[model samples]
Target: MEEGATETPEELLAKQHRKEKKDLQAKIQSLKNAVPKNDKKRRKQLTEDIAKLEAELNQKHEEELKQLKSPADTKVGEMINGVEAMTVEGGDQQEVKQPRVTKAQKRRDKKAAQEKERESRIAEAEVQNLLGERHQEGLKLAQKLAQRQLQIREISSDGHCMYRAVEDQLVQRAVPGLTLVLKELRSRTAEYMRNHADDFVPFLTNPNTGDMYTADEFEKYCSDVEHTAAWGGQLELRALTHVLQLPIEVIQADSPTIKIGEEYDSEPITLVYMLHAYGLGEHYNSVERLKDPANEEDS
Candidate 1:
């Protein structure tokens, strides 16, 4: 064991260069193994970093070769070996590996997400257009109703918009002692329709057979009107007019104002029928007098 051994700066610099090169390679592999391959931005950044580290490693290798060529610095230590020695020898301990998605798969998923967003935007626009049309109908109907100093009072659309709207007007006319108004009105209308079958029966066609209603079927129809929340329409309106002996005015967008029981001439119960007020089907809203003169609507 000779105690006089000494090392030159060139040899030490070459050892450091080898350690730095090893670190650069590990850093490049770590960058490649980063997660979330779908992140194009992060992938681009990693590509840049790997390129930079590789360039530096290449430049240092050239430097180490030129330094080691001198005969005096030829006594360098053995090359750093194995990933296990990386901590003491430049291992890049913080680097981790994760599974990555294929480029094709990532692109497909991005395209699908973009398509889904486009469809959502389209559906929203269609809904907005429908709302705009409903608003237009409201504005048009408002023009006719304004003459009487009345505004539309919205009725619930729970399959009984017509009956609920008629109930609203009946209450407004100060019909006294009206308990369970909708039930009472429906029962009265059905009874009238049943008794005056000659007037109503010829008007209704059996929906299933496309023929005139049989006696049993007409009775069932009346039962449904009173017992179930069956939707009300033209025939029901006519029956209601005779039952109450009251003129009923139906303001419509498509046709001239309908005057049911117009000959009665007492005051009219006013309602508006909207063809597209609801998405499912036509709907009715009751007419009420404006609360104040300022509430008068122009459109």
Candidate 2:
């Protein structure tokens, strides 16, 4: 082996340039590969960088061609080689264009949007129908209760006939806890509405009718009260409105209990059992306390 072999400055600089160029090419490939299969933003940036590099390479190729036309044509071949190394070393490194959106993908997106819109319409209609039915049922029950009370008052005033027994029978059949049942139903209904509000359009209070409309009735009313705002304010009123509309059946006074029309019209049973089962009967008894205005005033 030679005692002192030293690398020349030109050779060392060429080695350094080759190493730096190789590292830069690797970095470019890594970046190109970093573009996700489904990410539009990332692919967009990669496409930009690829375009820039292609443009620079093309410019260098053109400059090399121009030099080859002059007396200083010796360097042109080196420039051409550099241009080819920069542009074509990685055979896969063509312009990184945005992924094409297929016709099937466009069709899928459109179908999904259509299905969502159809479901929304159906849901809104169902909710509205339910509200209307509850309203009617509550009114019927309220009228029946009021008529029974009037009959009892009339018979009790007579004070000297079989009518007195009839009065007692009517009171017993009235199921002292009916109001409590209504209140419980209201609470449950409100809670259900609260929990599922995201699916609902939103409840809008109408100033003109003092009625509430679900979202979708946008122009006349604010679409929806925020969740926090909707929790309070007219819940009791809304519930009472629903309760007053239940259907009434004037059964024989000997019957153990009145049948609640909504979500329950099953076999006969005690008032407490029925109310507790449906979560309505327990609160019905509290209606009596509410009837005493003096107590309310004190509170």
Candidate 3:
């Protein structure tokens, strides 16, 4: 066995399975945090999704474990023969000759390595662009956040940025406000907007019809906000202020700060709003004081 190669194939496989399961659990927990308590239908759908992934993962793991129990473990043989092995013939053991590595194979391997490196470079560039280096904004915003002993917590840009940004702050800060998760926050915001139609409807326009939303269309819009993963905007932020009754502050690179619900007299949940942080456009990320107060200098 090579140095540091302590675990058997079965044991290594088991360890890998455990790590995968841990990652899955973390994702499920996030989903649970995002789903609203009162939305039974969505909750049920999430439950089914969890079952599908978990059951399949567990079953495949069990099957692999059973396969590893067999005596003809090819993986073990492969490991033994990987570097050096002997062939037994007529009660005598002889060293097996190593196969010559051809020039063509070496060229192919070198080409594959180059392709991988190119791909990695492209991915890094994309990430840097999405992080606002093109506009030189992330550094400025990050510096400002650090002043408050805070740093940015990036939220997924999957059209649910507004709600997820709010969700992150609530959980991260443990704010003494609404116990709503991401889905619940969506529900409450939609309901608030619907109830205060006079305040919100005037600002809304239906892009499909190219007209102001009629009464029926407005109702449908609210329904979509509650039930769908529709992208959120300024109107939704206003509704959130009223629903959660907590102030929200948005910091930007080259603009004035946006403050909402100042009347509530609560700690404002700060979020960084980026106009050029992503190719898909606008994104939101939560901000909080550095987790370790003692490490403030390093920040």
Candidate 4:
């Protein structure tokens, strides 16, 4: 045998199975010797381990038998000859060698791949359902504005979706190096709310408890919003609008009229209003970008 020669896939797998079986046997013996007979819990755990190891050993044995019954076309010794047989242009008949993979391994890999694809499809369908009419309306609007098709680019629906959505839009508009902008904006919004408590305190009510927020509760709420990954809401949005000093328009499918900021005079940054339902309650959904067909070609 050549020094440091790579083993055939079958040889490697067989070696691994033998090593595992030996290790498991050693573990079982050690556990039996060390564990006391009176210790029922330890005995039970050891018994479970032995059973699991036995099951694995049986599976490996079955695989070995199956492999032996139908021997692989390429073996470790044959691989060397196969490589040597390969010649330059117009030489002796050359055979292409492929790695040997067991039927069980192939089936397992195939099943895993299919499962991943299925999960991806389901996630995409859920996003589409969440967008619903808003997605359709956005597409129509895109056609009217630029005579082009639009595609939705989904953002993460985590608590910071609103800030993240705005950040994404800014990035799309060719803004450079603003990774921490969202965090900064969040801090600024919290500070603004604290400074102007009179304007925001009356509107601060806990959605879950349906009770007006006390000074301490509202303070803690602002702290959570600023420092933690707590979900942003209308209050945060208003603060963000003021801090950014830019008018924002929320376009909703249910409403014909667009919701602009308090000032509503400056050039507006537009965003779609996604709707989602959880049990009996409804909430704002994560935003998706309408990709322009013209921009697609450029990119």
lDDT for each residue of candidate 1 in 24-55, tens digit (9 for 90 to 100): 57645754554223324344666775676566
Of candidates 4 and 3, the better by TM-score = 3
Q: Pairs clashing in candidate 3?
A: 149-289, 149-290
Error of 1 at 14 (Å): 52
Q: List, residue by residue over 1-299, the lDDT tens digit for candidate 2.
A: 24322343234435545674565477567555544323233446567865665555454334434434544233333332343222235454454333455665456446545754764575465345335533334333334434443211112212111212222333445765443432244344455445554533245555688665544453222212221122222232233223433322232222343343444343221111111212222111101111233443354
Per-candidate total of colliding backbone pairs: 1, 15, 2, 0
TM-score of 1: 0.56
Quote each prediction's TM-score: 0.56, 0.19, 0.54, 0.45
**What are the lDDT scores of the predictions, listed in order?**
0.69, 0.37, 0.72, 0.59
Q: Candidate 1: lDDT over CA atoms?
A: 0.69
Number of clashes in model 2?
Answer: 15
Tell me how candidate 2 scores on lDDT.
0.37
Candidate 4, poorest ten consecutive residues by summed lDDT: 277-286
For candidate 3, the per-residue lDDT at 71 reads 50
- For model 3, the stretches where C-alpha displacement exceeds 4 angstroms are 1-135, 175-177, 208-210, 291-299
Best by the TM-score measure = 1
For model 4, how many clashes?
Answer: 0
Off by over 4 Å in 1: 1-132, 177-180, 291-299
Off by over 4 Å in 4: 1-151, 173-180, 207-209, 262-265, 277-299
Superior by lDDT: candidate 1 or candidate 3: 3
